[model samples]
Target: MILYIAKRLSAGIVLAVLVTFLTFLLLSTSFQDVVRTILGPSATPETVRGMMAAKGWDRPVVVQYLDWLSHAVRGDFGVSVYTSLPVGPSVLQHLAVTLSIIIPALVLTGIIATLLGVWAASRGGAADRFAQGISLVGYLVPGLLLAIGLVVIFAVQLKWLPATGFTPLTEDPSAWLRSITIPVIVLMIGGIANMAAQVRGRMIDELRQDYVRTLRTRGISTRAIVFKHALRNAGSPALTVFSLEFIQMFGAALIIENVFALPGYGSYAFNASLQGDIPVILGITAFGVLLVVVVNLLTDLVNGWLNPKARVR
Candidate 1:
């Protein structure tokens, strides 16, 4: 297990490096000028050129990429063009906000979906059909639309929570929790539905296996067989779906963040792209790539541990 984990981690590091390099190359080659965007229309050409030179944009693309990479290795992510604050600190603050919502949402979604899936699989009638329908709605609905509908129902009309904006936990923990409730629910809706569907499918397949039938024939209680034997085997595929969903939640929460006006890395990335803030955009992209790689590696390790054949290989 340790060896498998180490191998997966090594592969993830390599993939992250490659992703960062490609993202840098693409952003650097784009026609947009970070300096011009930062300086705005009133700035003279000399000013813009000076700003470019100061940012070392005048250097070759490879040189700039190397410099940025080196700085990243040393924990320096440069300054944000919009705020002139060190990009590392800025992004970290936003990342924390994102995680505050994402982590809880992931946990809640996983637990709720797993239970729903298992229960539906065990029943196999109208309840199962209803669960399937719920999953379909979750999978088909656009995240932005869901977020808007949630806000309208819970925040605007019902006045149960804040419509948007994030409050720091340090400032007021209660208010912070209150503020994030809707966003977390909005974010988890699709994830829970998708996870439940995957779990239900896997559970059904596991129940059909010969081993399950053998257990049943041996006079084992249905609950015991399903919970102990069936669930353990069914978990492997569910873990795979969970890992993919986690990565998607991390990177694709941009639309939800926008809808909730939450200050997160997703919103920063979106704004950076619009402003053509090359450094900030590249920094966020690098972090996102690293996150994805790490999640994939973790998933691989978990899957390997759950399946002996994977560990043996």
Candidate 2:
């Protein structure tokens, strides 16, 4: 198990380096545009050259990436070109806001989707159709439209929740919950649909296996056969989908945050991209790559727990 974990960690490290390097390379290609945005298009060629030289923009991309990586290892992500503020702290703060909603959404999605999927698979007929219908509706609706409609009904018409803005959980837990509720729901809808469908399909497959018939003949309770043996076998694939849902949620956050006016990682990253804020963008990119690595590692661990044979692979 230790060896397996070490192998996974090493692979994650390599993946992080490759992802960040590629992102950095792509961003570096836009250096000229970034400089123009920073210095303004009206600036003279001499002034632009001076600014580029001052910022070490003329350096080779490899050298620049190495320098950034060294500082990143030391927890120094540099300052934002647009805001002139430290990138690490700002990125972390906004990320915290984003995670506040996303974490809850993900947990809820897993639990609810699993229950729905298992129920649907075990009790096919109306129950299966119901689950399929819900999943289909969630897939058909656009997240942005769903978010807007929710805000209109719950926040605007009924006044049951805040329409925009966020409150720190530490400052006001009730308000914080209210602030994140709609956004969480929006994210959850899409995630649950996709995850539940995958789980349902896997469960159905597991239930049809010859072992299921043997278990029934051997006097194992139907519930035990389904939930204990079948669910465990189905879990490995379900978990893979669940892990990917985290990344999907992160992408959806950009739209959800903008719609709800939450100060979150998505909005921060979006603004940074628009202004070509290299330091901030790179900081967030590194953070995102690190997050993906960690999530994948966790998923592998969970998969190993579900199926010991997976560890060797």
Candidate 3:
């Protein structure tokens, strides 16, 4: 297991570097001038040129990338071109807010999906059909549209919750929860459906395996046979889906955050993109690369643990 984890960690580092380099390359190649964008249309050309020179943007692309990489390695994600604040601190602050919304949604989605999937898979009639229908509806709905509908019904029509803005959890826990509830639910809807489908499929497949049949023939209780044997065996594929879904949730949260006006990394990234704040953009891109690398490493570890074969040479 140690060797497996070490190898995965090493691979994750390499992949992260590649992702960062590619993101930098693409952004640098774009036609827009980063300095001009940050300065806005009203700024004189001389001011833009001076700002670019001050930020070392006048240097060769390779030199600029190397400087950025060096700072990134030391956890200095760079200063935001627009805010003139360190990108790392800004990103970290918003990331905490985003996670506050994402973590609960992830937990709820996983639990609900797993239970619904297992229940639907275990039963073989109308209940199963109903679960399938629910999953279909969830899959069909766009996340932004779902978020809009939720805001309209729960915030506007019902007036049960605040439509937008985040309160510090420490300041007022209830307000924080109320503000984030709709976004969390919107985020989880599609995730639950997708995970439920994956879990149900994996469960059905696992049940058909010879080992599952052997366990059943040995007079094991139905509950133990399904939960202990079947579910454990199905976990390998489910973990794969879970990891992918979790990573996808961050990307999806961008649009959802925009729709709900939540101040998260996604909203910051969106604004940075619109403003062409290269430093902020690069910081966000690097953060995303790091996140993907970490998630992939975690998934590999979980996969190896669940399937001993994965840990073998």
Candidate 4:
């Protein structure tokens, strides 16, 4: 098991490096004059040329990438050309803002969806139908639309939560919740719907197996049979999708953060892409690659732990 984990982690690291390379390649291919963008409309041609030379932006793409990568290895991601701040600290603050919402959305969505799915699957009638409806709605609706609708309902009309902006947790935890609640809900919808549907289907299938019948025949309680035995088997299959929800949450966060006016990594990335801020963009991409790789590695470990059969491989 330890060797399997070690191999997966090593592979994840390699994949992260590949992802960074691809992201850098794509960004470098853009036509935008990043130096001009930084200096703005008033900058003279000589200034732009000198700036590019000074920053080594005129260098070959591979050379520039290696320069940036070498500095990144030393914990210097370069000063943001636009923000005039160290990319590392800027990225961390933005990343923390993102995580504040994404982590809760992932955990809450998983727990709530799993419980509801178990209930719906066990009941297997109207409950099942309701779960299906949630899946359809979540799957069909775009996250932006969902976020807009939620903002309108909860913020504009109901006035239950703040409509936009964010506050740091250290300053005011309550204010932070008030701000993040809506975005988290927007993120939760897809997660809950997808996870619930997966759980429902897996449990239903598990319940139908002969072993489940035999367990029931041996006079086990319905709860014990469904939850203890069938649930374990059912849950193993769902971990793959559960792991996928991490990525899903990140994607959803991109839309939700913008709509909600949160200055998170998603919003930063969005603005950076528009401005051709390669340093910020590359920083975020590198972090995202590492995050995704880590999530997958953790998922593999969890799935293996849950299913003994998976551990042998």
Candidate 5:
């Protein structure tokens, strides 16, 4: 297990480095004179050139990426060209806010999906059909449209929560919850849609296996057969589905955060992109790629642990 995990981890690191280099290369080469974008159509050539020289942007692209990579390795991601603030701190702050919204949504999605899937698989009745229908619709809906509809219903009409914005948990716990609730629900709906179906299908397949029938014939309770035996058998595929869904949730948060006016990593990076702020863009891109790679690696480790054959495969 240790060796398998180590192998996965090493692969993740290499992938992260490649992603970072490619992102850096593209952003650096494409957006020439971010200073002009920063200063807006007003800055003169002399001013722009002076500013670029001051910021060491006049250097060759390779030299710039190498320098940035070295600094990024030491936890300094340079300053945000958009905000004139330290890139690392700003991105970290935004990441914290984003996680506050994303984590609860993911946890709720998992718990609810698991329960719904298990119930639907075990029962297979009207409720199961309803769940299946809901999942199908949810999987098909665009996240942006869902977020908009939610904001209109919950935030605009009902006035139960703020329409869009972010509040730090440390500032006021209740306000923080109120702020994140809408975004959470939006992301949750999409996740639950696909995840429940995944769980239901896997559980159904597990329940149909011969071992399940053997356990049932031995007078094992349905609960034990489902939860203990069948559920464990179903878990390998479920883990894979859940991991991919979580990654999707992370990507969806980018758009959702922007729609909600939340100061998340996604929103920050997005706003920076409009202004062509390369450093901040690079920071967010590198961080997001690394996050996805790490998550995938962890999922592999978990899958390997659950079924040791996976490690060799």
Candidate 6:
């Protein structure tokens, strides 16, 4: 187990480095364009050259990447090109706001989807139809549309929750919950649409296996057989789906945050892109790469724990 985890971690580290370096190389090639955008086309050639030299854009791409990587490794991702704020701290602060909504939504999605899927797979009639119906509706409806409707009914009509803006969890717990609830629900619906069907399909296959029949003949309770044996066996695939759902949730949170007017990582990244803020963009890319690597590593570890064969594979 230890060796397996170590191997996965090493692979993740290598992947992160490769991804960041490639991103840096691609961005570096566009340095002149970025400078032109920042300084405006009216600037003289000398002024542009001076700015490039000041930012070390004239340096070798490899050297520039090394310098950035060295600082990034120390959690000093330089400063934002537009704001002059430290990129690392700013990115992390916004990331915290994004996660505040994403994490809770993920947890709720997992629990509810798993139960709904397992029950649908076991009952195999109206329960199955109902689960499929929910998934279909979730998929067919646009998330933005759903968010707007929710805001109208819950925030505008009833005034049960705030329509826009976010409150920090540290400031007021109740307000934080109210601010995040609508966004969370939007994410949950999308996540469950993907995961519940995956779980139900996997569970159905597991319950039909020969081992399940033997367990039944051995007088195991249906609940025990389903929950303990079948669910455990089905977990490896379900976990894969769950991990993928997490990545999708991260992306969806960006759009959802905009709809809700939340100040978050998505908004930060969006603004940086519009302004051609390379340092902030690079910082966000590095952080996003590392985050993806970490999530995949954790997912692999969980998979190995659930299916011993996965460790060897």
What tens-digit string does per-residue lDDT give for candidate 6 at 1-313?
A: 9999999889988998898899888888788888888898798889889999999999999999999989889989999777799999899999999999989998999999999899999999999999999999989999999999999999999999999999999999999999999999999997898889988999999999999999999999999998999999888888888888888988877798788999898888898888878899998988887888888989998899889899996
Report lDDT (CA) for all predictions: 0.84, 0.94, 0.84, 0.85, 0.84, 0.90
What's the residue-level lDDT of 310 in candidate 2?
Answer: 99
Over the stretch 49-131, how does candidate 4's per-residue lDDT look in tens digits? 79878877778888888888898878888877777788888988999999999999999988988988898889978988888
| Model 1 residue 238 CA deviation in Å | 0.8
**TM-scores, in order shown?**
0.91, 0.96, 0.93, 0.91, 0.91, 0.97
Model 6 ranges with Cα > 4 A deviation: none
Model 4 poorest ten-residue lDDT run: 28-37
Candidate with the greatest lDDT versus the true structure = 2
Please identify model 2 stretches exceeding 4 Å from their true place: none
Off by over 4 Å in 1: 30-32, 39-50
lDDT of 3 by residue, 1-313 (tens): 8899888888888887787787778877652477666667898978977876787777887788888899899999888766789999898888888889888998898899998899888885887898899899998998888888888999999999989889979999999999899989988989899899988988888778898789888988878988988887788888888888888888877887787788898998889889777778888888877887888888788888778897774
Error of 6 at 116 (Å): 0.4
Candidate 5 Cα deviation (angstroms), residue 178: 1.4
Candidate 3 displacement at residue 113 in angstroms: 1.0
Error of 5 at 176 (Å): 1.4
Candidate that scores best on TM-score: 6
- Error of model 4, residue 12, in angstroms: 1.1
Q: What is the lDDT of residue 125 in candidate 6?
A: 95
lDDT score at residue 289, model 6, on the 0-100 scale: 79
Compare candidates 2 and 6 on TM-score and give the better one.
Answer: 6
Clashing pairs in 2: none
Please give, for residues 1-313, the per-residue lDDT of candidate 1 as tens digits.
Answer: 7888788778887887788888888887653366666667788988977876877777887888888889998889898777788888888888888989888899999998998999989999998998998888888998878778888988899998899999999999999998889888877889989899999999999999999999988999999998898998888889888888888788767877888888998998898888877778878877787777777877777778678787665
